[model samples]
Target chain A: MTIPLRTPDGRWRLWPGLALIAALAAGAAAASGALGRYELNVLTTMLCYLVLAQAWNILAGYGGLISLGVSAFAGGGAYCVALLASHTGAGLPLTLGAAPLLGALAALALSVPLLRLRGDYFTIGTLAAALALQAWVYNWDFAGGSVGLSVPIARSPDLAQTYLLACGAATLAVGAAYWTAYSTFGMRLRAVRDNEEAAAGLGVPTVRYRLAAFVLCGALSGLAGGLIAYQQIAFEPGGMLGPGWSINALLMCVVGGVGTVAGPVVGTLVVYYLLTTLLAGYDAVSLVVEGLLLVLIVRFAPQGIWPLATRYAGTLLVRMRRTA
Target chain B: MSAAVVLNGILLGGLYGMSAMGLSLVFGVLRLVNMAHGAMLVLGAYLAVLITAGTPLPLPVAGACAVLLAGGLGYVLQRHLLTAMLVRGANGPLVATFGLSLIASGLVALRFGSDPVSIPTALGTAGWSLWGLDVRAAYAVSFALAGVVAVALHLTLSRTRLGAAVRAAAADPRTADLIGIDVRTLYALVFAVASALAALAGLLVGVAFSVSPQSGTSYLLIAMAVVVLGGIGNVLGTFAGAILLGVVQTLAAAQFGGGYRDLVVYILFFVVLAVLPRGLFGRRLT
Candidate 1:
């Protein structure tokens, strides 16, 4: 018997989009050898956030669970290296390898209690928990307190290597998103998001799917955090676990195209470029603009700018050519 | 540990009740979370602080003006920005409010800097005794005011014709609209009232404790707990939730430590939400 390997909606057509990102990453790697120190750092940080946005997309966009507490998982990922350095003096590769696993464990712990809260309560619950954990981390000496943990300099990756590592993670993240867009697992997540009751009635194992998504997202976020730790060399709790990181991910995922494979990637690049150019060195102005931009996008383009552009781009281009 | 702590807890809860009231009311009527509610409350406190600090206005007078201005601001927001958002869907409004909060906090930070700015009033520090319990003058006043506002709101919801229209809309907006009750206007009025309540709570919180530009998020967290605990949309239940939370917090603080209060409160909040999400007195949300 023949088996179907695609979602009924022909989501596989976007596989080319995945290949395009792969090609771009290859191009970015080849060009990174000649880039300056500042450009290297900026690009690496942007790629880390790109991974975060893609991770957030899987949870909120596909699984229909919104969380602003992803920093907790990211923090878990970062601390893997920190803890190892403080206690065991593990090298960069080993510490980085442990991040996704630690992050998934942290997410699993968070989800058991978090998932029990229904509907909108999850939003506030996760936020409160994250903040509480942050505060607790400030007091706990074992976790390096609020001063935060440092990666041992001897084991740190160089700028060029860090950029390539970030590129690797970004590729994995985008691949995950692309897989979700076309795979049965992603279909179940989308189903649970659209209507939990109906999906449950259809024997979709909604909670399990949701838990799996949360864990996977958490692991991905952890990987991003680990990459940042390697890059920054010594990062603090405020820098890593602050609401700023979560807010950036939210802005990128929503504005780019929530639930679409290319949305978070597009959103990430667009927002990163905008922040660097338009609101550089102006924290207050950035907050104001980001907030306003987020509101406008939600109100004006609920499905997000990238999705709308994709829908209209072909027709608009054809019409322009005809007029010309 | 003592009656004094219990009294202090209840007094502190007064502000939380009103803070949650605004969020609960909007949720009841519109079925949407007001992510900007806390920012709106902070804005109210800022207005009160500005008038009290910069102008020659008395604390009470400044507070009153803040309340009225906030109510008017609520009307404008509901009628203009939110009305359009609400028509889109539930999630759209959430993101919209989230954005509103970001803008509000950013503006506050830009205008005043991130320093703590309290009402230049001595209401919280000034103390008095009644029935062998020590009470701050401001806390006493707020506790009494909470009583008055609670009774006023309850009576309005129960007895007034205007309130009846709001209730009808909350119960079933489509039916109320079909019955020619002007659901949109009712929603606008409800939002205004809720916003005013939030501002009043903000004013009280500023006096009883202290308010800063960034104080919005903590108050918002507590409000969510109160709303969740008492039930979403039930006014009296919100106060009940707030009172319980206050008692729990103070007790936790006394027994464990101040740092543990948030740990305890948030854990309890999560546990309650997990166990009985409808709240002790709230209706089924879904």
Candidate 2:
């Protein structure tokens, strides 16, 4: 129906927000072109991760599936594009389109079987799936095995356009995540997440909602994967399916507050800034720091920084009202 | 392919069973999946290596000493670090254990410099052949040690007061506390036993193969799979799951080479999760 965005309180105060987002995207794109190539590449990686992590939030944070294998799905999409690009005469656009579709297909296949698990079993099952997928890619000689396949360098001689394109993809993903999280279906998903048995009793079709979240999560992660493939211009199985991406997604969701529209964005920016500045060139140290961060947040700030901020904001509003 | 291979798988499964028992025990008692369990195993292995480096004591004695050390460390960790964080929620334990895992891995990396180390054992070049199948001395020793550990564990769990207290805590901490069981003491003892078991598994692995900082992850994953497959909160179930996993792994390795071995085991794990969400050995085993 091509409906415009509608927030939680269904007010017609959306045009300004859209305009602001559009301006911000434009500014980010322009800044990328003005910055150094390395910085631009880092920004691209961050944007791609933002999309992937936010998409995973749809399932893990909202629907409460907590899949730790998002990188596996992302890697699957990357390998698909790499293999297809090598064989066929497809362009970047075609690769981007097919990557998400293929990822969605994989999700559909895995979800039918995986959705049956309960509690931590589901999480572990998904992790096992990720590990197995990595193993498959590692040994599957046709996909270049563990060494991975390389993407040809961009011959277009235009860095600005590529930066803009990546930004656009990221913005599109954010919009998709926001829309899905705010829609009526999203409400049903929340109901399911809150109490699956109760939701099922209320005829919310809990399994269907979960499967939809899984599919959406898979597609968005695939888009991010395709973007990453283009940005790196290479695909490596070990690098793509590594636990770092999984940990990053978890960190983002936990820090930003899962089940919120702006949580992942905030989480990503915080984590990315910390990684780029504070913990640069120290992989083991960073991992320990990250692990500590996760433990602290889960223990002391389970509601996350955003949700806490929101609560304080609400309190401030109430104080102003009382004073008036 | 043959009885010997099945027997070997069964034997190896015994050790895997032992590896997973500690993790399962902790999870059952606390409902906290310790992400650092593998790190504990590595810590135990390294401790064994350091203690018996030039000592005339036999490898088993050194292994026992390592277990005691690991148990003591585990007691301290549970008393100090874990108790504070465990009250929040299930995810609290997961995250805390993750942090502990990082610390353990980093500390080991710092101390050991990522070098692979093996405990010196005197069972070199010895084997018993049955129907023309060669069984190595190391495998025999590993299997025997594993069996001893498993039997001892079974006896401890089934016949001892401490084991009864541990089981009570595992079943219901609140109820156990109401019945005058000191939960703090039970938790410490459970952790100590679990860590000791991890250390024992580490010693077996070290002498049978080799040990390094990076080796813990693979063992951790396998232990988790075993716990999940056998159903959580049950020691015998862990044993059964471990043996099943061992057979699956060895067969997969023999059939598809090392690359697909893990892949096949993981596929089975997923299948088990999908079909029997409660695990192959459900709560009934506990």
Quote fnat for model 2.
0.51
Off by over 4 Å in 2: A1-23, A30-32, A154-159, A309-324, B1-3, B50-62, B76-87, B114-116, B124-132
lDDT of 2 by residue, B1-286 (tens): 4667776676678778878989988888877777788889988989888877768777678778889999999898787767666765455566567667766776777677777887766663467775677666666666676667667776787798877887888788889999999987778777888898998888878776777876676677788888878888777777888888887887767767777766766777667766776678786325
Structure candidate 1, residue pairs in collision: B231-B282
Candidate 2 residue B285 Cα shift, in angstroms, is 4.7
True contacts kept of each: 0.71, 0.51
User: Local error of candidate 1 at B206, Å?
Assistant: 1.4
Model 2 lDDT vs. the true structure? Answer: 0.77
**Weakest ten-residue segment in model 1 chain A by summed lDDT:** A2-11
User: What docking grade does candidate 2 earn?
Assistant: medium
Q: Which residue window of length 10 is worst by lDDT in model 2 chain A? A: A153-162
lDDT, residue A76, candidate 2:
79
Tens digit per residue, CA lDDT, model 1, A80-136: 877886589787778888998888888888776677656466677767867777777
